[model samples]
Target: DVKVTQSSRYLVKRTGEKVFLECVQDMDHENMFWYRQDPGLGLRLIYFSYDVKMKEKGDIPEGYSVSREKKERFSLILESASTNQTSMYLCASSLVSFVMNTEAFFGQGTRLTVV
Candidate 1:
């Protein structure tokens, strides 16, 4: 089964603090993505890495960054967490061949509350 694991199910951060959320997949998928889901706005991609050490900016890359040093791991970094940044962060992974229209398996999601 394709599995994606996220570091936290919930996180609380003070405003302006740096936060890191880790994701690991055991399926050796080539496409990894970081996205934040907010009410009304839907899922907005933060970043995505197609391969190890390669990254691409998504729809909402501001205040967020990502790293993919290994094939199985992807990390999302919030440079400065703010109250406005409070949202549900979701990590997903899929085979490179299924980049379009294929369902990306997701983590349980990390609900971040920045105060």
Candidate 2:
């Protein structure tokens, strides 16, 4: 199976703690994205990487950051955890191009709670 999956399904962090959410994709996809899912806000992009060591800030990148040192792995970092940052984080991968972008494959959601 061409897989995109998170390493962690649940995490708990205290305020001011740093958190890392890990994901790996085996499809050799060129694009990977991080998004957060909230009850009212749905899914909002936090960051995306189009290639290794290259990344772009997404709609909600203020408190979050990402790393893509390798093609198959993408890591999301929360510099300092906060109660408001508690939410479901999702990782997605897609093979994309100007001509035709393919459907995104998503990992199992990670539920993060900060207290």
Candidate 3:
């Protein structure tokens, strides 16, 4: 079955520390994404990569960055963790699509707490 796997289910970090959240996909998908979810802000995209070694900054990329060194793996990095950054982080993988109709598979998610 197709799936996205997160290296950690949860994380806790002190303010100003650097944090890394890893993701891996079993399916050989060409597109991968990282998002941060908050109550009102909804699922805001942090970063996405369409191909290996190629990345695009998403809606809210100010404090986050992504690495797509391999086709099946994507990593999200918090430059300097802050309490405001505490949220549920999600990783997703999908096939490249020309048409609008396409499906994305998501990881279970990693909840990060910045204190």
Candidate 4:
């Protein structure tokens, strides 16, 4: 079965702490993404990498960064955590389909709270 593994199911950090959220996929998908879900705003993309060593900023990438050093792993970095950054972070991966973008398989999600 295709799988995406997130390092933590829940995380708590203080303001100004540097936080790292790790994700690994066993399916070798070409596209991986990090998104944050909040109460009213819905899911807002933070970062995405389509290939190793490549990354693109998404809608809400201000306080975040990402790394894709290998094909199966993607890491999201919160440079400095803040109260407003608390949310459910979801990691997802999908194939680079020729017809259209394939459906993404998501991890269980990491709930983060910044105090």
In lDDT terms, which candidate is top?
4
lDDT of 4: 0.94
In the range 12-92, model 1's lDDT, one tens digit per residue, is 999999999999999988999999999999999999999999999999999988889999999999998889899999999
Candidate 3, position 56, lDDT: 97
Which parts of model 1 are misplaced by more than 4 Å? 99-102
Write model 4 residue lDDT over 1-115, tens digit each, in one string.
8999999999999999999999999998999999999989888899999999999999989989998999999999999999999899999999976368469899999999999
Clashing pairs in 2: none
lDDT of each: 0.93, 0.93, 0.93, 0.94
lDDT of 3 by residue, 28-102 (tens): 999999999999988999999999999999999998888889999999999899999999999999989737577
> Where does model 2 exceed 4 Å of error?
none
**Candidate 4: segments with Cα more than 4 A from true spot:** 98-101
Worst 10 residues of 4 by lDDT: 96-105
Candidate 3 — which residues are off by over 4 angstroms? 98-101
